[model samples]
Target: MRRGAGIGAIRNREMVQAKYKEKGAEMAETQMATLSRQLAQLRTSLESFAAKHGTKIKNDPEFRGQFQAMCSSIGVDPIAYSRGCWSEALGLGEFYYHLGVRIIEVCMTNQKRTGGILPLNELVAQLNATKSSYASEISTDDVQRSIKKLRCLGTGFMLIHLAGGRTLVQSVPGEMSMDKTSVLGLAETHSGQTTMSLCCQEFGWSEDRARTALNQLVQEGMSWVDDADPTGERVYWFPSLFQAVRSSG
Candidate 1:
């Protein structure tokens, strides 16, 4: 009888525990539902805000940057999609989408000269010169946002950071060697042209070292040989930078 009683107590305890477990699960589910609803409401409000201020954000670079910051704070990407949720919410999807297409075109046309990398400022200047209809209002922020959307195409569009808080657009697929990167950085500092003497004087490199690096870049089509330089010194120019300089001149 004692054994039977103990078994009954065990069963009773299990039943009680099961009841408590069910109650806990119910409470958790209720909490989760409440949180989900709150999040949904917050998202609705944010969408409304984006729709209302879409025009200001699209037209003014400063305002657009601030809006982007706010979206980021909420873990949102205002320009992530070319259509659907973000497009309907912000109404600026088409603008960035079209800009991204143009960016791809520009990058492809100059790929041989730039070796798939070009400074952000140079890109903006070229885009403006080539597409004058919206040039006056275009800004780096707008271009960056547009480029961010381009990543979805898996075309390997990326932004690279340089030594001086400068950024460049890299539209090609390969990792650049350190020597090549350094050579390009040096070229940027000297108006896109660098000679063996300049590299040796500026970076304390040997003549052979500078020449080897420059030749590699030339072979890879990242730079152009200016053997016909007026000074008779072999000058190598990073084409993207040289293009910008030529445009301004």
Candidate 2:
């Protein structure tokens, strides 16, 4: 009788555990179904909203920027016209394609001058100065999106969010060295100019360490050497600061 009772108890415990496992599996399946319905609803709502505001999204840079942000929040790339279905519904393929070509042209045409790392302001300024097929005015947000699309193609386009409101666009493919990057950051504080002493003073780097970066920039046409500083310390000016200086002037 004792043996029979023990076996019955073990069987009851197994039955309870089996029921719990079945309940958990059913709950998981129901939750997944609910999530799928929510996602489908979200996609439909986005499509409807985009259809209503299609003109503003295509013609106005600021409006387009906001629209892109909305799409991004939901992990949607409606502006990527190269991808099939979104391109047809939004009709923004030509606009982004034109803007992307223009960006590439601007970066390539001026690479010799700015070493392919352009200030976002300068890029926007240049983009607006010309007549683009799709846009009358280009915003930083638009430029950034276009760059993001270009980057997906495995190109070298990159955005650098610098301190303050300044942004940099690197058009080339190579990864910038840490030393060179630090030097550029330091130049941002001193009206786009820095020297070995300033770099050393700010970063506590040795003279040799400073020159290695500054000299490479100078050689790459990114920085212009000015031996005429009144303090007698050689100054390296970043061409990347052109738009900011011009706007202030």
**Most accurate candidate by TM-score:** 2
Per-residue C-alpha lDDT of model 1 across residues 50-142, encoded as one tens digit per residue: 778766776777887888887777677766534454576455667777778888888888797787878898788778788757533668988
* lDDT of all predictions: 0.78, 0.81
Q: Please give, for residues 1-249, the per-residue lDDT of candidate 2 as tens digits.
A: 999999999999999999999999999999999988988798778788777877777778888888777777877777653454456556766777788999999999988878778988889889999864754578888788889889888788988766555778888886667788888877876777888998898889999999988998887677899999899989898876754566667
Q: Candidate 1: misplaced stretches above 4 Å?
A: 1-42, 81-86, 112-115, 129-136, 196-213, 227-234, 246-249
lDDT for residue 114 in candidate 1, whole number 0-100: 85
lDDT score for candidate 2 against the true structure: 0.81
Question: In model 1, what lDDT does residue 215 have?
Answer: 86
Ten contiguous residues with the weakest lDDT in model 1: 80-89
Name the runs in model 2 displaced over 4 angstroms. Answer: 1-11, 81-85, 132-136, 227-232
* TM-score against native, each model: 0.68, 0.84
Find the 10 residues in a row with the least total lDDT in model 2. Answer: 80-89
Candidate 2: RMSD to truth: 2.8
Per-model root-mean-square deviation over C-alphas: 5.7, 2.8
